[model samples]
Target: MVDYATARMNMVESQLRTNKVTDQRVLEAFETIPRERFVPDHLRSLAYVDEDLRLKDDRYLVEPMVQARLMDVADIRAEDVVLVVGAGSGYACAILATIAATVVGLESDPELAKLAESALQEQGVDNAVVIQGEMNKGYPKQGPYDVILLNGAVAEVPKALTDQLSPKGGRLATVVRSDSGPGKGTVFERWEKAVGRRTLFDANTPVLPGFHKQPGFVF
Candidate 1:
């Protein structure tokens, strides 16, 4: 029998801590949440691995390291409301719920949303709610959010989502990548009428359902 509890601890120390995921609150969040519960039972044995776990609906649970890095970069505060796009299975939402005042997990797949909501309920995650809808559109009804984390990578973040950030200090973190090169974790902060961005780390998270880059003109 796999001791999932011990596996979770090892993941925190080796995959997370070794990767410079230093925020104690974030670390504790990862430590307490049982990642296995959020994944399909067949894949649960590999839950603690340092890679993305395949989920239904063509989405994936962003790898543990990438997820941790994004959480650390977002700097979610205790009183902040957050929004997670492509929240697959609710693992990211569950983790963010541990730190944020409220987390709205928006998933485009109804099946995945059900799984996420059920998992969160089983785990007693009260601060977060999973809703099924379009990933690119974002759940505007719950806006504006203090922090927005995309659980998957994107070729380019939609402007509509950027507009959903809570004014002033609201930030969004995601892995931006292209078919031509490696992905990099980037954080975007809304400032009045502008959004400032900076790279956080080199990473490659699975791309969200509708975030693919449109092709450019070719010869």
Candidate 2:
């Protein structure tokens, strides 16, 4: 059996810490969460590896580095109610639960959502609730969340999602693409009625489903 505990520690010390993820809470979450439980039985051995772990459908548990960096940039607070978009296997949601008061993990894949929910519950993560839904449409029923973290990249940040940010110090994070190419992880903060955004770092992450623009008519 793979030593997942050791692997998790190495991931935090090497992959995360070495890459600028300095937040103590974020580091501890990564260390504490058993990533092995979130992946399929066959993939469990590789769960702590640095790459993104593929799940059912075309979804992915965004790469470890990207996930860590996104959390580091969001700077989640103890009282924050967070919303996680495209929460693949609930790994990020579980991590967020450690730092935030509550987390709503949204996923379009029914099977994945069920699995994620079961895994979280099995691991005794009570602060997160994984639900099935379209990835682009933010979970409005739970909204006006303090922090919104997209598990994958996007061609553009949809207004529908940004509009769900809390009217206070709400913050959102996701990577944007340059015509389906590479992407840069960005953090957006709501300032009164307007939202201000800034790039945190570059991460070539997969774009979440439903966020892609419809194809234009070809000539």
> Which candidate comes out best when scored by lDDT?
1
TM-score of each: 0.97, 0.96
Candidate 2 lDDT, 102-194, residue by residue in tens: 999999888889989999999899989998988898899999999999999888888888899987879999988767556999999996789
Stretches off by above 4 angstroms in model 1 are: 217-219
Q: After superposition, how far is residue 185 of candidate 1 from its true place, in Å?
A: 0.3
Residue range 89-187, candidate 1, lDDT tens digits: 999999999998999999888889999999999999998999888989999899999999999999999999999998788899999998887899999
Candidate 2 regions with alpha-carbon error over 4 angstroms: 217-219
Residue 154 of model 2: what lDDT?
A: 87
lDDT to native, each model = 0.91, 0.89
For all candidates, what are the clash counts? 0, 0
What is the C-alpha local distance difference test score of candidate 1? 0.91
Worst 10 residues of 1 by lDDT: 53-62
Residue 219, candidate 2: Cα error in Å is 6.5
